[model samples]
Target: MPELGLDTLKAALPEYAKDTKLNLGSVLGNGQLPEQQLWGTALACAIAAGNATVTAELAAEATDRLKPEVVRAAKAAASIMAMNNVYYRAKHLIGDPEYQSLPAGLRMTVIGRPGVDKVDFELWCLAVSAVNGCGTCLESHEKTLREAGVPRGTVHDALRIAAVVTAAATTLSAEQALG
Candidate 1:
């Protein structure tokens, strides 16, 4: 794909929403993380947000930079988080001692072996958790990432990618709704 492939997605935003367009550009161009890692995180966030357009566009663009296994791991991160986020978030929010103590019984083998660098997988999980609005998952992933020696700046950049992709997807949804 072209170097500006992400720009194509960014341009899909309504021209009047200059701030969202500019934010997409900035996040996609962020240098705090490697391009591969950034795109991987974005792909996971897009998938977690259930935005088919953004997910397909990001996956197509990321294939050039990320290993196939790495890309798969990003997808797995989104899928697993989709389940875990709901369960864990409910447990946290409910705050009932009985519910919190119960075994989640969630299948999350992917977290242990995501077929990529563990930190990269964790970063993707963090991005997805952010999109899923699971404060529990977010805190867990962020702490794991930081303890694993991942820099805070890199974590921030990954979250930035998640935020921008989510915003862009919402913009596209609004565009579709207005049509």
Candidate 2:
């Protein structure tokens, strides 16, 4: 299989710094998360970050390893988290008991029929939630993954991918703006 290289994206960054390269290497390696989960989570977080370069790079790397359904699940997770993170974070930050009691009323049918393994989709959601900084979604997805017997190491590695991808996206975006 081909390697996941951030060659082009790195070129857009400031001198292709060591830390970003190392983090990419660590997450892209065959680590705790299965290859599919690693790539899927990376893609979802990339989408959440909304960096075209990173998103395209991750999508290209993920295309072969991930089944179409899995890719869809990743996209779905990012989309849903984009909406949910805003709502839930507001609720949490506002500290309004009434808001907590109110229904979200958002259609999240994709969560039930994600077109991929439910646990895998949940993992993607968890990763995106991490990037979005949604405490509520993070707790819910983490609980679901744990109940489904997902190892903490796997979860940690997925979060690592999310963190690295997010940082890379931010770096690339700043480079684009500055250039």
lDDT of each: 0.84, 0.84
For residues 133-156, write the lDDT of model 1, one tens digit per residue.
999999999999989998899989
Clashing pairs in 2: none
CA displacement after TM-score superposition, residue 148 of candidate 1 (Å): 0.8
* Model 1 stretches astray by more than 4 angstroms: 1-4
Question: Clashes per prediction?
Answer: 0, 0
The C-alpha TM-scores of every prediction are: 0.93, 0.92
- The CA lDDT at 63 in model 1 is 82
